[model samples]
Target: MFVDSFSRWMKLYGMRRKSDTLAFVQKFLADMSGTGVPRSFWMDNGGEFVSRDFIAFCDNAGIRRTYTAPGTPQQNGPAESAIWRVNKAGHAARLEAPRLFPKIDFTRVPGFGRDGERLWRESCHWAAGGFNRSPTKANVGRGTCV
Candidate 1:
């Protein structure tokens, strides 16, 4: 997910593999939200962001990378906080799926295991996107962001 520092726009992606970051970011860069390649990326020291393909793409795009100190996520505070908020909302939204839409039995969804992880993931996506677009005290009077 790419959380814009200024707009707090959270791009929640459902990735099946860690390497999917490269593809997702590439697609994101081509989308309307990506007006221009960001000058730098402040990220965690995660293997996904440090993968060879991701590194190569960032190098070619001239996007500088800054990793937070190991074990210290607060270095990237705002993004982390936004992620927490989105996750909390997403979890609640997923739990309320039955109540909100009783007709669909998540456990019985096609192509998903009885655990319903995929179904919950879809709910998370919807909930996060809605939270992203909702009005916020921090964004008052600011122009729209994708």
Candidate 2:
């Protein structure tokens, strides 16, 4: 997940494995078109973020990487704060969805069977979309509804 600090626009990507981060980020940048690559990225020093491929990807794109201090999530600022709200919204959406949608498998609701994790991921994706479209006080005049 990446959030624009000024506008509060968010980009969420669901990955099944750590190795998938680079691809997700690359695709995101490609999809961004005119925005061009970011000057720097703030992220925790997780293995995935520090992986050789990820490092090379950033270097190739001329994106400087900044890592949060170990064991300190607050250093990530807005991105860290937004995560919990995203999760809460997702959980609520998943739980109340049956009531809201009633039928329609509600548009490709995945067959989770016993895989509880995938369900959560799908809900997060759903909520992220809602969040992007829904208006928020912070974004009202700061320039976002993306």
Candidate 3:
């Protein structure tokens, strides 16, 4: 949902890391493929989603990419919800370890870069698996989402 190489803000003297665009895209594709690709994908005007390689990949995969107008993120509600969930979960996880503070690098794992990219890929795999196993309020029967 959030397709940026990094989204960390400089709080003081250090940087907040974020997931790389390539890794996120690969995981996103894998996740969607498992559930059946949607008819369309809504995105922002970020360079990450507009990259030549990304656009070509989407085109080849027969996925339609829809971009929201500049400064109009509300138009992408589903994506915004997904991004909010990811960020909220990540932040909640970090908050549980407040004692670590500046000593830890929570954002480092999710952000871009060789190692960070790998971490993000793994996180997606784990997340998808977990979500599939977990029961959803929308589901009426006693079965997993996937």
RMSD of each: 2.7, 3.3, 9.7
Candidate 3 local lDDT, 1-146, one digit each (tens): 43221221001111133326656666666755655654556678888778888788788878898899999988876556555555454444444443556576655544533223324433444444344455555444543543
Report the lDDT tens digits of candidate 2 across residue range 1-146: 88877656788877788878888998889878688778888999999999989999899999999999999999988898778878887877666766676664644655533223447777787777777776667656343344
Against the true structure, candidate 2 has what lDDT?
0.77
TM-score of 3: 0.52
lDDT of 3: 0.53
Once model 2 is optimally superposed onto the true structure by TM-score, how far is the C-alpha of residue 26 displaced, in angstroms?
A: 0.7
Q: Order the candidate numbers by lDDT, best to worst.
A: 2, 1, 3
Among all windows of 10 consecutive residues in model 2, the one with the lowest summed lDDT is: 109-118
- Give the alpha carbon lDDT tens digit for every residue of 1-146 in model 1: 67878867777777888767788888878873437778898999999899888899999999999999999999999788877877777667666666778888767768444444456567667766786667767688653443
TM, every model = 0.80, 0.80, 0.52
Q: Which residue pairs in model 2 clash with each other?
A: none
Q: Which stretches of candidate 3 lie over 4 Å from their true place?
A: 2-20, 97-137, 142-146
Which ranges in model 2 have alpha carbons more than 4 Å from their true place? 101-118, 136-138, 141-146
Off by over 4 Å in 1: 103-106, 111-116, 141-146
What lDDT is reached at residue 137 by model 2? 78
Give me the candidate number with maximum lDDT.
Answer: 2
